[model samples]
Target: MRAFAAAAIGLTAAVALVLTVTAIGPPQDGTSPEPLLTTVPGPKK
Candidate 1:
């Protein structure tokens, strides 16, 4: 019974970690903070 309980807890933790990563998406390398920058200012219509 103890072994079975430990396995269940491990499985639950693994699943939780996977779900958390998926929801946040995979890590990105060399990603820029700003891809586009506008310098011009236009009058409001």
Candidate 2:
């Protein structure tokens, strides 16, 4: 019974987490940024 209760609690927490993540709406700014790292140096090895 104890194990069952623990499993139930864990499952509930996981479901809640998934719901919270998905419920978070998109960014309001509507402006997507570009990558910060464009090029890499230090070669010829």
Q: What lDDT tens digits, residue by residue, belong to model 1 across residues 1-45?
A: 999999999999999999999999967776778867567667889
* Candidate 1 Cα misplacement greater than 4 A, ranges: 28-45
TM-score of structure candidate 2: 0.57
Q: Each prediction's TM-score against the native? A: 0.58, 0.57
**Top model number, lDDT:** 1
Model 2 residue 45 CA deviation (Å) reads 1.9
lDDT of 2 at 11: 100
Local error of candidate 2 at residue 5 (angstroms)? 0.0
lDDT of 1: 0.89
* Superposed model 2: Cα runs more than 4 Å off: 26-43
Whole-model lDDT per candidate: 0.89, 0.87
Clashes of each: 0, 0
Window of ten residues with lowest summed lDDT in model 2: 30-39
Q: What is the alpha-carbon lDDT for the whole of candidate 2?
A: 0.87
Residue pairs whose backbone atoms clash in candidate 2:
none
